[model samples]
Target: MKPLHSKTEKALAAFACICLSAVLSFSALAAEKTYRLTLAETWGPNFPIFGDATKNMAAMAEKMSNGRLKIRIDSSNKHKSPFGVFDMVKSGQYDMGHSASYYWKGKVPNTLFFTTMPFGMVASEQYGWFYHGDGMALMEEVYAPHNLLSFPGGNTGVQMGGWFQKEINSVDDLEGLKMRIPGFAGEVLAELGASPTNIAPGELYTALERRTIDALEWVGPGLDLRMGFHKIAPYYYTGWHEPATELQFLVNKRTWERLPEDLQEILRVAMRTAAYDMYIQNAHASAEAWEEMTAEYPDIQVKQFPDDVINALRSANTKLLANYADNDAQAKKILDSQQAYLNKIRRWTSISEEAYLQGQ
Candidate 1:
């Protein structure tokens, strides 16, 4: 009877070992499987700095994940809908997107703050706020409700105020004038009685050239030189608005959740690095482009608005922001946070960077 019992126990143990081995084999197969994600960017195909950021992110993710993660990017030209990025990603049509946050302000008004403000922090200051301050949490609150996530993708430093057909000598020059602008800057201009409009990137040069639009602010010299705006617009104004225009990376909540823990970390690190790289790349490109423009384009005169005109625009911008803060609880919180941070950080900046630049 003892021998019979031992034989039965041995048989049961062998069967259990077979099942355990099968489970281990399945787990290994699942772990080794690859995940593929699709990204849609708001830039045209082969676009310089902006497009390069997305490509860099994808490359890093694949390399870090050891080929278990792959991302395919489709530029605006391929997707055929530059402004539809937010909606498409939200609807699961695209796993991720790269675009400026301010572009969707019409649909999500609170998004107006994330890109940049007329009198906001510079690139270094804003990056500190995003990584060490309330910027990330505030951004998450704004985007999470929409089943999406947003991160700082890149910064264009200070944007060129714009290329104008006429110099803005006073507040009177802006009144009743039509221009191509976007984001909160447009609202600030609207407060000053300027008719501000947004045109597609591809149409900007044509619109301004043909008098369809009086002026347009695309980007700094890094990109503007290629647009040929300098050839037509004689007065290239220095930046007042969009001091630090930071583009964003948007991810579908579902897509993010589907990623493995390791891959998710890899993606986050890649995006962060890519964004920082873009800031450097833009600085280099802008320096090079400005050198070229000065040498070749003698007609391109860089001008700053008069003090009075600047004061009026600043007042208008302040008024509009105050009105927005009064109207929305979230807006007020974000504005208050940003203002408070700027107040604290600007002192350090003034003593350090500002003083150094002045002495130089």
Candidate 2:
């Protein structure tokens, strides 16, 4: 009987040891995997679309990862200059960054397709171009040469032309005007007899205030109001140069590759969500800002350019497009591809975007 009781005790001990080992192994597997990333934006917190959606994306990414992957977002000057952020990410100086795609035109001429073009697709159409058309794949191919991965981060829909101190009555008014604009718009502005300067965001207000620049064009009403351009430039102009401006997020190819598949998918979803949020928020914010500015800043007059002025801009834009076709092969490819896609999608906008706006 004593031998049998001893045998039973030995069996119980062995069973308990097996259960403990299993629990330990599972705990080790469940250990968290944390990752850190830096997202940079050119604008401040009040800039609406880009800033607001970026914060939300970081928060949502953190939440979706369930503590397994932790992301640290430094929105305002935490990492680098707005334009500098893209290079930093491409070189692996930072894990990721956010800025408008046109900022890096020198690095990737095709990048402007992802950002914005003169009289190109709207926010929704641009989104469709990326997701449904070959836009994203083409963008990835363009970024491959730069050692970076790029995605559409946000959009401001159709942006305002810009704020002008003087009313533009004709192409003659653009002559010798020092305008703070960038991307293809700068090229067109030059064609239209204006000296287009690509000033950094922080320096624009000072440049305009010091009389170094005759006019400046930032995002739109909400963002421009924050910068207090209304006080300085009474004549507000339209952003016919930039019908729609899209923002981008760039990640180092190596760092992006290192991410687990699930985490990569999480990032893609987060970016799409951020873009959607940005467009919606900016539209409302611009309206609110316009209302506030009109009520408060009576001296700051706002008026759209006359038909003649718009017609001059249109002619300049056509000349710019022709130049791109003649001189830039990559630019021609992007323009042709984007236009082809738009031809197909613009049909739907009649009922979608156009009809809604007309009803309003």
Number of backbone collisions per candidate, in order? 0, 3
Q: Write the per-residue lDDT of candidate 1 for residues 110-164, one digit (tens) a residue.
A: 9979999998889999998899999999999999988899999999999999999
Native-to-model Cα distance after best TM-score fit, residue 292 in candidate 1, in Å: 0.5
* TM per candidate: 0.96, 0.87
Clashing pairs in model 2?
160-239, 161-238, 161-239
- Give Cα-based local distance difference scores for all models: 0.92, 0.79
Error of 2 at 211 (Å): 1.2
Candidate 2 weakest ten by summed lDDT: 40-49
